[model samples]
Target: MKKVTLKKNLSAAMISLLALSSFGGTVHGESKTGINADAAILVNAETGKIVDKYNEDQPLGVASMTKMMTEYLVLEAIDKGKIEWTDTYKISDKVYQLANAPGLSNVPLRAGDAYTIKELYEAMVIKSGNGAAIALSEAVAGSEGEFVKRMNAKAAQLGMEHYKFVNSSGLSNYDMLGMHPEGTGVNDENMVSAEDMATLAYRLIKDYPEVLKTSGTNYKYFRKGTDEEYLMKNTNALLKDRAYSYKGADGLKTGTTPFAGSTFTGTAERDGVRYITVILDAKDQYGQPSSAERFIQAAKMLDYGFTQYETVQYTLDDTETKDALPVQDGKEAEVKITVDKPIKVRMMKKEIKQAGVELKLDKDKTGEDGKLQAPVEKGEKIGELVLKNEKEAEYILDGLQRDQKVNVYASSTVEKANWFVRSARNIGEFLKDIFG
Candidate 1:
């Protein structure tokens, strides 16, 4: 087995991909955000910026949605040299049992079958196969219980509020071991909020965009060296066979269970911008006995996010703050610094506004009062550049309430001087300032 550290959600884990500010990112105002599902949320794929939401914080069965995290961990392991795409694992009695278990979603993993990691991953994500999910979890973490522990830990690390996992497959209301043997009665519904689902989707797409390549799949898959196969129709109706299909719609996962109702974490791209939306406990809005309320709502929400909002990229002036600040007791009286990276924020384009930037420094760097004192080195972190809304007195980004803080470093080295020389330089600077 290979060891891999799970990452927080992409916004939190992939700093290079999405540099969420410390105050988070500042939005001037809220957008129209309401959904019909029991819970739902729409977010920008790049920024993890929420455009709108409703009951997104309410916990409920995530069903096969749990497989998203499962896939994340598996891919994470493979990416870190822990496992290979072709690595294979033998089917345990548990997985085989799940295949034969009536009414449970599975890809028919017969006993004595050796399945490759990639094959099992597809079954879990594309088919929502419970057996394949357990097989992958056990292979990676040694046991389903241990695998679930990693899931919860990763969820918490991703800043999922009050989320919990009982099983890797999100099979709820069933005995934990009923399918495999070592069983107990644990109502592990795989609880998660719609907002968390959006976060999870954002990270998966941000860090593993490749996952979308398979989201369009709607078919029955076969295990390696096995003659048996099951029709693996994608649960996401928008992907195919529906009136809700939209341009740039691609891959994502859907989960449904007796208790979970119908839930989906969907993604699509339009005009160079991608959007992810989550709908939990969806309804049959059109009155079709099998109406795909999930897909309909998902399409509506995703469309709203894409057409109503846009991600803005702003670069700091060519230089870091562009001006050198006085440094006490340094050979050079002042030092310059540069912006570490450009700022990317999600905002509405209706009435665009330039994001406000505030440069903050450590008191010590500023000597005692708000001035810098030192032998500051080039590339040393002196402070951070914060992004704020011009209307901060009235608004904020809906979900990410914190301001964004980018690390600012000293651009040049400034060495300390002899006390006499330093004192003389300070006096001259003071006298010059006074005269000016």
Candidate 2:
């Protein structure tokens, strides 16, 4: 058997049955639901709330969606001053050959030809050019193999729960014309769970919003007004002017292969609210692989998000308790408690209705009588005020708790009571107990 991974062994009928069991059957209309993919996820870009998901944690082939990682590492290098947009690379023989490979998406590049980092970055981002991606990878880390290590390391740092990068371009090693990164199998392909892809997209947008400038563009000329000029059209069909154009569709990336089928990591913003959606190995109704199917599924995820979700702010007053915590051995008998700050969450209209905060105090800091010990400094962390939702347990994004919580701090300092005051209070309590 070949050493390939990420492709499922289920038949079309079995896949559909799995979808129905996982999502309660495909529905219709404005409340439309269900996605025809092996795995999918929708999330609030600002709040990191997973709005909905289907089999989002299963590791699967991501195809060129892996380029998002390549893009991230390049941007990071530029930000760290390790490289510059004006920096240039002389096309390597392997990259040059891959650029001209038949059937693979690429921008024309000749061996020994020098291209600026900016030009190659555009080719990779705007056109999903495999050669451009590999070239940029080599420039950033000195070799595609080293760059692949950086990609996996960055994925872990970004809180990605499940991912594997065998090569920078996401192409099967066999497709690399025998030039795939050393130590990786020739049949290997990049793999990531939909949840991890969402996490990657979130970190990309958060860490470098500048990427949208390139990914958002629908088309651009690789070498404008030159003899070797080649027009590169964005592979994202949801972009404006495309056959399946959608409003506010700007970035991020799309991919397809016999192994990965069709996948997309899409981001869009409208009225200041942004959402990130991921669809992996999307298939048509009959369970046949189709490039257009990913967009169709993405449309449903985006529509449900935009139409049903809203950003709501929860403040200190929203917490379940405003009661003061009794202080033991302090000059003052009690101290005020409240949430540290306001938290913003993107929730469905229904989730908002039942949304509220729950207060939890630290037991270690409290006395046997359930009172806080004295010498409490102003702004001391005593506990946490957590956002509570009835449906929170059902939310996806595996290994990610979506912990929307803030530290509960003391309103003011409560110094320890002097010996005299302590004695007096002790006597008073003794007398009260006897008289009662």
Candidate 3:
């Protein structure tokens, strides 16, 4: 059997489903008690398909959510062998200034204190530490200015066009509190569109899956090496057993600032379908004391995704041929074609039948027996296959504006016959002409 690792998504806690009977129409129109956000989006993590979208293109200040990129770049540096888990970075005066700054989201760090890769990463991710973020930025690129450049470059590389990062920590330029480095050209808070935010989180999870190990941890301690330890609470309230405890919610990040209000990128998985929700600039709950508006909106969006749509995974087996084609002038009479690799197509269960899933052969390359000629190699291009419903196809062709033209491949190989085998065909042709 071919080796393929499929992590089951459903959990026992998900057994008690929240029957979103009231907020069903929130996706289409605004509700008084629905997701209170200026922009929001829920995406199918598997297919990159949008389930619910509201003003997702409008760029808004992302605040601490910027750490997602910060964390990603750190992990990427480690992956590239430029850094290591044991490597330590000393806290600089700039880092201490930010950490001690009034009202900044950061753990207290004294100047010259050193933190290892694992410790600082946990503080940055779980505590949303501005100090840790800036420290890592300096360690990675030698300066916050250079790190911000890399951040913007990485965003563009990931196709996140609607993103701008001016600082490692997502603090606004206006809210700098005179803590940024002298003559630093930083002039803006982090800005990101909902769609781009989800794309960033999706890419981060896909590329560095180990991020979940820290992002999912609910609590930890920073400065474990010293007595000045600070308790770090995972800012993502959706993951905790709170009023909006989403069963499968693991992480991403959350941000709240007076100007940005609240921002969040939450990730969850249920029944094989992974969901990512982005909410930016959410309304602060009127009279509610806690900073839970983002978490509530994230939970509502995730619940809507899980209940409104059912995902079906179609096993795209590339090893076995669902159909075979007869070969000509070859050692073998036929050749088998299939998908080139084991893949899964996750889509709305309702779209399965109407998805217009048709398996077509490369007719232009076929032989007289309606099959490709011999000498066909395994995994050779044969044709095209699309897992799409009418809406999906139109979305790609029109509004959603996706360009995906992929080719299907053959599953097996076939070799050509030698000269003696060609003589047999020549003899048959000669006999047929004589009889005629």
lDDT winner = 2
Arranged by TM-score, best first:
2, 3, 1
Which pairs clash in model 2?
Answer: none
* Minimal lDDT window, size 10, model 2: 23-32
lDDT of 2 by residue, 319-424 (tens): 5456477788899988887665677766778778887887776888777876678878888888877788746443333444567777888888899999999999
Q: Pick the candidate with the highest TM-score.
A: 2
Better of 2 and 3 by TM-score: 2
Q: Give model 1's TM-score versus the native structure.
A: 0.72
RMSD of each: 10.1, 5.7, 11.5
Off by over 4 Å in 3: 1-34, 181-187, 284-290, 313-322, 326-337, 340-343, 367-381, 388-390, 393-436
Alpha-carbon shift of residue 35 in model 2 (angstroms): 0.6
The models' CA-based lDDT, in order, is 0.71, 0.83, 0.72
Say which prediction, candidate 2 or candidate 3, comes out ahead on lDDT: 2
TM-score: model 3 vs. ground truth: 0.77
lDDT by residue (216-256, candidate 3, tens digit) is 88988776666887789888887767567788888889887
Least accurate 10 contiguous residues by lDDT in model 1: 1-10
